[model samples]
Target: MNNSKNESVGCIVNECKFHSMGENYCTLNKIQVTKHETTAKDVQCTDCGSFVKR
Candidate 1:
């Protein structure tokens, strides 16, 4: 597992396995980002495809 710190990659998903404890950051070296909508409209249309429920 690529358990590296990415200071710039902030995550608020506390239920995610990759979410750092007591912090707003992700421990994963990389994360898959995907579009939820058919057409690219706004930030809301995007989601973290790599989220794994803990």
Candidate 2:
């Protein structure tokens, strides 16, 4: 696992493989934001497509 965190990417999902070790950030240089709903209502309607089970 890459413990190096991308300062620009803020994340709190500890279960994600790209999540920074011991920090609330993402290790990936970039991430995919996917929309699951027809209308962009709120945060819950979107997902981090780059997420991988740790």
Candidate 3:
């Protein structure tokens, strides 16, 4: 896992493979973000494409 202090990848999904245990953060070096809809109406329309099931 990356311990870089400069990175601020915060996450709450404990089921994700890249989610840091007990840290509420993502350990992936980078994440791919994508829109779930052609026209996003709210934050719920966004999705983290880098998510992998643990």
Candidate 2 overall lDDT versus native: 0.91
Off by over 4 Å in 1: 2-4
In the range 1-54, model 1's lDDT, one tens digit per residue, is 556656878998989988887788888888899997899699999999989998
lDDT of each: 0.85, 0.91, 0.81
**Which digits, one per residue and each the tens of the lDDT, describe model 2 over residues 1-40?**
4569999999999999998979899999889999999997
Can you rank all candidates by lDDT, best first? 2, 1, 3
Q: Give candidates' CA RMSD values in order.
A: 1.4, 1.6, 2.4
Best by TM-score: 2
- Candidate 2 lowest-lDDT run of ten: 1-10
Supply candidate 2's per-residue lDDT for 16: 90
* Model 3 pairs in collision: none
Q: Model 1: how far is 18 from its true place, Å?
A: 0.3
What is the Cα-based TM-score of model 2?
0.85
**Candidates 1 and 2 compared by lDDT, better number:** 2
lDDT for model 1, please.
0.85
lDDT of 1 at 18: 89
